[model samples]
Target: MVDEMQGERLLATTEAVRLIPMRHSEARSGRRASGDFVPFPVDTTMALAALTRQFADSGKPVEVTFRKLVHWIRSGERSSHYLHPYPGKLLPHIAHFFLANGTYARPDDTVLDPFSGSGTVALETVLSGRTALYAEANPLGRLLTAVKTHPIDTAGVAVALEQVRGSFAKSRARKPPEVVNIQKWYSPAVIAQLVRLRAAIDALDAGHQRDLMLATFSAVARKSSNADPRFSVPVRYRPGDAPARPAPMELFVSHLSANCARLATLGLIDGLGEAIGAGNDARSLKAADGSRLADGSVGMIISSPPYAGAQKYVRASSLSLGWLGLTPASQLRGLEERTIGREHFAKASWGKQHPSGIACADALIAEIAKENPSRATIVAVYLSEMRSALTEAVRVLRPGGHLVLVIGDNTVCGRRFASSEYLREMLEQLGMTVVLSLVDTILTRQLMTRRASTAGIIATESVIVFRKD
Candidate 1:
């Protein structure tokens, strides 16, 4: 039998192991050698024990009884630990623990994600048997979320594909603009066939249309682009790298059919909630000021905000966004504002000056000096938006509700902005108590290395859990 002191030590040791960059096998081996660590049969139990200890150490009061800890550990042990196969998609394994631990639950709860990129949280919430509300400012993002969550009828989708094929055969007489584009990416004959197919899909009734079309469109957007095959984001086109573009019609049909098959396999056709695609600003949130939702209304909040200075989402999705009738020109000027990075600021400065000219140089230098002059301005904007979002979340949540926010840090001009820390401060200022700050290895890695280095960032991110008092 383990005594209390030994148990605490074991929990601490296990948590330390979790923080180490080792595989599960390595952790097990190390634990065995350490002799002070308990051999918990399940990985999640070990993880939970670490998290519980972390919460206690953070000076946040937790009233979880000993029985609850045991139950939580047991529950985690039974839960699946497999990673979702989708690379760009959110990790289901991480989400499951949050859900099971009641991190997003209330007496009566509705989940909301303001920056709901790719709709992972929203979809997961719905799949986990809860209602979710998702709002995204980007149209492409909104469309992707809408398509993923919308239900489909496999049988109807198959019939639609067949019809599209037949229509493509008949429409060979008349060509669509997409056909010309497809010809650049695919063989001429393949392009011709695709054009016909797209026309058929376009002819279909709007009410019965499935997300298969959008998925197909997205698929071809990659295959038929003039951009580098290796690069996911669309960059300036280079010579000889351009593949034969597929005809718009053919590409659309292919995209539709392929996605239909994938959706059918996933068996996610029914019971999906409403997912709207609108050009709303995150700062404004399309809500009246001072509107507070009923307390304890929301169950969870999960999202990945824009990286400090990485991908230009609007430009990257220009082709797809255009196809979906969401042109960047239509979005707000601020929405199109580039992620402020060190380089961007430098470029703005360079644009304003001439070499060796006093006034010209001074004016150019002035613009450069003004670069990121408003760190507080950006923070204020983000905080104001978040406050509105939180107020709504708090109103909707029942007493003792939880909100889980995952945000990475940003670095500008060599200064690190601890975004999560700022968020913690802001939430506390708004009367919420910090609950758990469990750091995931993958997120930590990306913030500290990948995103930071690629975009010249100098900061790291922290995952924060907050509860409304």
Candidate 2:
């Protein structure tokens, strides 16, 4: 081993800051709830620091036994991951950790993510020389994920950018689609730019290039809209607080330039490993079936299922969806109602429904039903849906394949719901055994203090592993 001075060079250098909420941040602008990374709980950070250096210096595929993906609990994403802004996205560092530790997966095996939000897992898998498959329910999410993960040459993206500019200059723009309460979300001028951008993207033939432009358009639309896209749907702004719209072509080109430069680093996955994906529900991955994975073909599954009340994911993307004509505001209500974890139960019922075999969840829900029956119904709806999701995860995984679920625990009327425990019980009923578990300290600023529990807010997330055999 090197002496003290030389050893310092081997460790990853990290900047530490207080985890408290502060001014001059995304939280301050009300544009985001979670702030930048801050080292926290001292011990976890120090332990993770040591493990990260070991993994980094190894330079070979890592074994899961010694992996500490929780290190990324404070590590925000960088590189191609910056192409799109998605709330609650799984960090690329975490995906890289899990894939490296995939001892069950052989060199030629495939990795799958049923809820591949923004394609972090798929991108990491393909880049690491393993094939991957993705199924994301939100169409906008699928578009962003595919564009972020796919690798197109700089020359092709440049040509597509020029074509978009030419289309805008030729005066061939389409009319902006109308929706109910449109003015409340976007100003008339912003709508005009969205329509123009949409027309330009449509000018290109359907391909990755077109999709990438649409993804760029999605980002531009969010910036140009009147809605406060901080946490969830339009956090109604004060009359004078409406955001100013930038010149469409200039804004789009600038975003394209920055993203293209970042993507040059991600490039495309090398070797024969490819990412095959489509917009489809994770509850039913019918879109992912192919000659490669026809019979329980996926060797590994890593995902972060939608957490309860995290955010109305579809509503957050309404700005992106509106520009694409994927869903109108009037119709978006119905669309969100049909998706899991996005539903709002009208006039509660403590209907006594529970996720089958999850006694801990049922018990917690029952306790909440005693205080406020309505909240209990919400609890039941979320966990029952998680059961269906986990069942689907089990179906696609090979008999010996592994499934790693990243989730957080939360509360209902001060009664704690240990999501990891409930999920473990559910996995056991599905013929899987719990293999490993870790509770990573949450380094994010606590945004939902209103939901704080008498047991104190859940300040950690459980990373649970299950193996089907």
Candidate 3:
């Protein structure tokens, strides 16, 4: 129900000084070097030279103004998108608007989303006849995206559901998974039933049926668990705050049917192009055939990368990951360490103390670190990883091609952090020119984050567009 309020447009600006060579805080702090904060300037120089050669006229970015971005929460996401809800999931209409607009005007073009959570961008790409590359890090996200985008075998799905339901018809004894603190998240009854459903789905024939069934299981996994669906982390109930818990079977059946029905609208579109979904770290993205977007080949790069200290996918998806057997409870520690924004590695063990070469991020990191050293380390680690991934994004994009990122700022430890502005600086350093930066209102912040921040809780997010040229 969110509509555009008014029309105001502005272009992003960056000072070259933002890319100064800085000391590794980890080195300065006398800690062991993790090399996670290294930023190579030669790559930036080459990228900029390439861009300069591509656009000789201004060699600067072209800015566009938009008065509206449609509804950021619920506008064009009325179909299969509702099958699974994700924490801080991107809006479908936002992707559609970018695709429909001049950012990527050709339907035969190729699009990429490095952090393709739930495949919002990929789905929009194929529906518009354009192919997509969805490189995601989370296995659960990979499974959901694969099932959501591929053409469902309606008959096979039906048979699989019957088989799944029939297997559990005998009311056999069920044991909860021996994963980290299962009892804290689910009651004995709920845990037993969810495990039964998982075993049933896993035994099914290998095909889209099992895929769809697993997706359904993931979609409904939180229904019976203490995992707080409202936020990224599964929060247990507080004392005297017992929330209403539904039965697992009821949630699975209804959600599965709804997902199947919504998918019915898509016809066979295998010939239009390919919508490839690969699970890997966005920082090191690639295609299924070990292919990358050849240098200067991509039409547009669209994604909403992980926010710094904002969204934690590892903690958010623990229940389903354990249930799906993707990451066992004991092994989750390793996964958290690898995840972009996770607080797995201690600040003392951090490789860097300052944000990598971005002046704005460095200043903010310094300010936050002044209050709490731990928060500063978090900011530095998050931005360092982001710079690497974004640099790769620029490398694959064709000169003059636009890279549109949907991002919001953060207020950690009660300090204002300009996330989009910092991202703009990083892209600029990676040889990208800022085209347009539009601010849009968010209608559903409550569902996106567990608790509101003192800094207005991301009341607005910006769509920062950059061009390789």
Candidate 4:
């Protein structure tokens, strides 16, 4: 069995900030009416950004307590956030606080999320009237982010969904694609139902509408499978005690309908900006015009990066990848190789050992190597890749642009690793000044606490903000 111990790191943290709304009365009044277009809440990102102007002028880094900022409550599931499930989602409120306040980004300015998982930041950026550019290694994630941020005619979606539902009963059962160990994760009967649905979805003309249907199908594929629904990664449930699952077609119809409603709400927003996927690799990103993203062109970046050996993102989405025909069983490992914090590596690469170039990080790697050399290599490679990603991020950010990272610490090799501290150090070395750092306890997130007998709980997270020099 692959060690789950190494790939279970805490991810995506946000600090509580007091929201001092400039137009508090107007913002609050919109929420009172049902179905009214409530603007993004006025919050601390603007307040803090305004407060930091004096320091920005003098070129000094300023730190402040997060709780001292103003506060307000907003719904996290308002837009396309509830479209699909994703591992380690950052709270939408956190993204809204910064994006809406114009602290770092203004209307029509481009904001980037280098590790844009499931489009949380991208959707927020679009809703805030700024163009969003994102880079994601997972094809499924790229599609999810794409569909979530872009708007489609609801009338057309309604018609397409009905056609799909009608065809599900009559469509021919196509052969299921090779998903590794398909029988282990799904019953033969379930596989037949899924393939029929896939065929029905496939009959549609390819476009955003088709993509939306495919995403809904992917969710149904995961939900109706024999894998445990409670866990992030696929794990077969005990045979006798496994909970009964809904039929795949029934689930897809219902899920797609609700998602359509979510999209309708997003469609109502006037002047909603665009979100473009800049390809799979973050270390080398491109713009919508098919050219390399120009240096010093972006106004802001907000992302929650993966933890080294902490997230099994590829494995978790394997079922969807197979169903969507995005990655086949044969190319699974190849897809994983592009991910930043991937756990697997070539056997030959295990013999290589290099210093991460961060002095404190290097000492930690050496300590971890004494316990598990392979694990040490995984950590080292993760840092090296992140260095390249950060280099790219710094290269494209305008001098005064803000970069926000939501990250958490974790235990590896029985030692506590301060991921926030290490990342802050790396950013400092890259000539980015730390403007704010705040830590908050995680109340609840889409995370699995136990992995076999070794994984530890991720209780708190840190939100670090930086400005390019």
Candidate 5:
């Protein structure tokens, strides 16, 4: 009877031990001596402990709550308004979160965005009164960043515009080669006017004056293209015998004027940081990897990397790339050859070729095991490149610096792809801790296809944060 009572007491004690929520420190210190170990934070510990108990009682693991985790990742207070002029490129509310949360605030801090698409983050960094180093592989994206971040003397811009108008009035010539292809997408008169404008801009002497002129010219490129601003594909004017679209030179002028007006509204002309847009690949950034930058050099890193096999950047920016003297064919072929995807992973010794190649192959193989091989290679390659970038970021960042990655999950061949999770894992492996993962409420209509819209649904994007540990 005494032995039986002692055994029952021991069993009861074991059950009670399993029922209690383990403290975070216990888990972190690895002091638990039982099979019922749970990771930190009282809430997480209690929830997980209860889950394990229920699972053990049922003889099965409880169903995973991936949706709940995603919800938790995205939950945050939204911002009310944007401080910059081009709020459309970046959701103002999201940008405000970084500012309010002290993600990009430092008196002597600089920010580096390896994949600075459209200059949203860079502009925000400058608006927050910090220096930003913006780089992009796509010429058009680089140009956009350069133009948006370039400082403008409001008075000087006005005088330059007046001079350009004077030059246009004096010259009466046919559209140049650069503006000729643009003609098919615009009205003849508009094309002629744009040609003259380009000439006038080209004639300007070197300085910020020239940059301002180029900025105006670039702002008109979208209007000069076919309507709808199809970012992923070519600007198709006629669809199988449709009449040629008319150019809206006046509309383009108005757009330029509005941009100038918006600049005036923001009063950003007084103090803007240097915005260099020279074409450089994010994978092989100009800076040396793992080299130490000045302490507290960079405050924040905000960027959106390329989605695997989703956007053929060089092809999408063909017109601009052509003008910038980067051959589209070479770049497209190179990107295709080097990008990660399912097919590349099947080939053995993929990583032996290039550092990115190995990562792409590994990612591809991992996804293939789960039967999602379509773009896994590219996603993997991006992860590898991002790892290199993160190393650079760490080298350049000050202590307690922040890095924000605006990313979206993708689906390939009807299978869900969790690129963000992979990125988080990679960053953590590099000794960075995830600070927060906020879901951005802004919805983008681009990149939605009928396949992705099956059952009329699409996956949302999230803004993930990481701090160097």
Candidate 6:
């Protein structure tokens, strides 16, 4: 939580630099530039302006080749991307690079993101003046994407926010939703504040405005909890050992105000193509109307798929899930199992080994199973699921459209798991021709600097571009 005095200083400093042009990394890192320190705050228009500065440079001479593209783009995010906090989001520049480049996809063309984690690709697509189509397995991610891409009525949201603020004291505390080990995650005072805030938010008419408030509430739900802030996954601190934090309602109001400003800035963009959310599963992508996606319908597809047993997206979202009343604690495992790269499996399914059909992948699985059979099964399942997802991606992409995948390698059972290689082989078998493959050094990521014993630091990521034959 931001301290009150510090928050005031931040607000003042943000207002001062609102007109200055700053680099993406410089603004984010709070580096001293031209003898003035610019720190990243929750201010909305400044962030929007900083991101737009990158787009303004589109007129400069540039080539589309990988070597030229690498230097042409930089990591930055639009204001809407800050509407919610999501783990392992693809850097906005990567998606912007593909969408803005006329060779891969042009304005008004439709782009699809099957994984759509937090709608990074979708937001970028819309900003590039292309229609954005996406499907996300996690309900929280889907909701976030929906809110991020849509334009918000700032005046209406502000009135509603004030009403919510006034009603908090009078709002009755509703019974908390069923969350596993709830006591370990939140204190009584925090829970009371959250439930009351939930009640107030529920009173509003159901629409985009309500969704904006809900997204803000969800962010507060995570920030005000006992979970350790350093780690992506929830790690509860011992009772009374947790540090002091801001009140839940205070956090909600501050975040909602900032988010509203962000949405207003997003609304300034003209001719932003619509962002549509397809159904949950990537293996069988569909349209928002529940219609099947026709073959060769999408002009391009871009995604950074979940790695094999490396991320715990479901677990990371469990807190928000319960607070939003989307899923109860008991059903989290079921939700986890449904995702592509889950580590857990039923005992019956574990007994049988499934081959990914790639000789090298199967060989690696066999080598892993010699020591930990269950871990090996996780790897096999990950590969199998990705194959299905990729098949669907290829099925919907236009013949000449490109499929750009940003993936990285990780360790499984203490051995190197070449996931990027496996994906390339799988795409090839599906008849997709590899066009360009570039490896990027990861500067910072959601995962710990040193990951758990089984997984090591993912130092680099491979960006592979493929075209359907």
lDDT of 3 by residue, 189-282 (tens): 7788888888888778787768888888976777677765555577776676767755787677766666776554343333333578644778
**Model 1 CA RMSD to the hidden true structure, in angstroms:** 14.2
Residue runs of model 4 more than 4 Å from their true location after superposition: 1-25, 28-35, 43-76, 448-455
Cα lDDT tens digits for candidate 6, 185-213: 88898998899999889888899999999
TM-score of each: 0.64, 0.78, 0.79, 0.87, 0.65, 0.85
Query: How many angstroms is residue 2 displaced in model 2 relative to the true structure, after the best TM-score fit?
Result: 52
User: Which lDDT tens digits does candidate 5 get at residues 1-469?
Assistant: 1233342232232122112254545332222223342211122334434544664577432343333532221232111011111212444334433543322455346677777766766665554445777766555566566666654555565566556656766766564444224545555665566667666666667776566456556546544665336444455655663344434334334444444543432232223344444236554444334333444466777777666544444455555444333334445545445432212344453333233334543654475445443344445556666667666666666677777776666665555556666676777776787655555443555534234531122345667767875
User: What is the clash count for each candidate, in the order shown?
Assistant: 32, 0, 1, 8, 9, 0
Worst 10 residues of 3 by lDDT: 7-16
Sorted on TM-score, highest at the top, how do the candidates line up? Answer: 4, 6, 3, 2, 5, 1
lDDT of 1 by residue, 196-217 (tens): 5446667666643534564455
lDDT of 4 by residue, 1-469 (tens): 1112211110001111123234545452222222355446453455766656745576543443333343443444467787888777777767777775646665657899999989989998887767899999999899999888877776677678667766887987768997878999888888998999999999899999999999889998998888887777888988686777767877776677667766765665666778987768889989887799999989999988888777788998998898889999899999998899888887678738677678988898888877777777788898889888988998999999989988877666666667787888888899998887666666564543544433456767777889997
Better of 2 and 6 by TM-score: 6
User: What Cα-based lDDT does every candidate model obtain?
Assistant: 0.47, 0.65, 0.66, 0.76, 0.50, 0.76
Mind sharing the TM-score for model 2?
0.78
Count of clashes in candidate 5: 9
Best-matching candidate per TM-score: 4
Give the deviation of candidate 5 from the true structure as CA RMSD: 19.4
lDDT of 6 at 146: 95
Question: For candidate 5, which ten residues in a row score worst on lDDT?
Answer: 78-87
